[model samples]
Target: MRSIIAFFLFIFLIHSVQAAPLLQATISRESQVIGNDGVTHTSVFQERMYRDQNNVWLERVLPKHHQHSTDAKNKTSHKHLDLSETAQHYFLDNKKSTRLNLVLPEDKTVIHLQTVDIEMLGLTNCWTCVFSIFDSQSVKKMKITQQGNGYTWYESQNAKNKIKIKWAKLQPDQNPHPTSEYYATMDSIWKIHLERICRLWGLNLVKE
Candidate 1:
């Protein structure tokens, strides 16, 4: 009887870990730019992030009136901007192999990246870091300062361009779906490089 009870308990523990709910959070991004006329323009947007034990999903909320051009000739060759409704899913296995799938709902297309180098692309192992959309190299060049609260502020500038980011503490999410099938794909190389780069920059990487 004791052995049987122990076996059942072990099974239950395994099931609990496999069925754990995803962690969700809302990420807000604000951009300010000074035009040639010396006018400051500001824009804000929000994204949703969901994370499970081994996967992450990032959804970019688009405006309801947002339109997509179907003109093939007018289409830009840039893979990142060609999407209408953008979402990304990342899968990481126990061995640290990573894969990404870029889901474009409007175009009904999914871009699969079988192998990705996160450092080369300026990405980190932390899912939240994706909110910045800037490569790790660029992030290294940016200035980081602690805000009054738990928030962190980042800023970067060049002769003709400037960017700023404010990172807030993550809050508990009430709803998050299971890992979806849309996002990019990566390999272990990505994991290795991303961890190294993040460490070099004194950035934290979420480990599960």
Candidate 2:
């Protein structure tokens, strides 16, 4: 009886460790835009993410302290926005096949999608891959080119859109905080932009 109780205690401890939540926070993000008029503008923001096993929550931090609105008559209105309202939650299940549930906070709506491809389950940890799963057709057409150790370049078939990413190096004793910088160019509209990630936590880097 003593040996059996010890075995059960060990199993419970393993389960508790596996159920721990991972918190990922992006402290800052800088975005630079160059328009056709030869003008450049830059903006910065922050984001937070949390993952508990198969569920993840992504929150985009709005720069404004209050949510602003304009009436039909062009009148401006301001209202305080709750931080909790900014999160979009994702739930993934891979029991038999890959399945996803995207929950939108504003409308309290749940979007469900399922696929037979098992590989899709592994991509939930990536920032881009989460959205790419919704548009697998477009992802198939895009070409990926690796420049070197931490640089990746992507281009459209028409060459009208291009994106380059610089990934951060892995650190010791961490759950993989994969911060990155993105440089995107849209030749069709003569626009170029650079988005840099200042800090990140929790997400794993999957190099394509």
Candidate 3:
């Protein structure tokens, strides 16, 4: 009877841990856009994400050259990519469906994003939606090839346009999330003025 009780308690403990695991990570990436005129533009981006039982946070900073707008927020140590410093923030359970905030310090607008927008962000949701990348329809359209323990996502339809996705430094178990992620695309080189991660996760800056 004692052995059976211990066995059941051990199983219960394992199940409890598996039910909900905490994820906290920061992913950095460098991207370049190759123009048709043979000019290539490079940018650096960083994403900080943290989630536990009741609280959540996510922030993304794009290269000054790639400065664009959407909505999201937060603060982490970041490097100066250039003069164009732009960013955004989101709140998962903020109650409001939509919102927009202007950040004076960065000289750009931040869009308040909903958690539901992960479907539109592809692997970026690795910042918020830990499991969505595996199920996103957009990701499903790409060819995902395993790289050691990581996976690489790339466009299979267009030859000239390219977007590369890779994740590294995943945790051993219990709701693993990547410690680093890489994303790059050249499809909209001419059209987009800025590339932001507003819809990636609803986050508010820790300070001004």
User: Which one wins on TM-score?
Assistant: 1
Candidate order by decreasing TM-score: 1, 2, 3
**For all the candidates, what are their Cα RMSDs to the real structure?**
15.6, 13.1, 15.6
Name the lDDT of candidate 2.
Answer: 0.41
lDDT of each: 0.45, 0.41, 0.37
Model 2 over residues 1-208: C-alpha lDDT tens digits? Answer: 0011212111011111233434444445566667789777777656555554544455666656744466788765436333334344454443522244433344343334344322343324343344221233443465766546654444443345454333333455333222443445552222222233223344343211
Model 1 spans with C-alpha error above 4 angstroms: 1-18, 35-37, 70-84, 114-208
Q: What TM-score against the true fold does each predicted structure earn? A: 0.44, 0.42, 0.39
Off by over 4 Å in 2: 1-18, 68-85, 95-177, 184-208
Over all chains combined, what TM-score does candidate 3 have?
0.39
lDDT of 1: 0.45
Q: Provide the lDDT at 134 for model 2.
A: 22
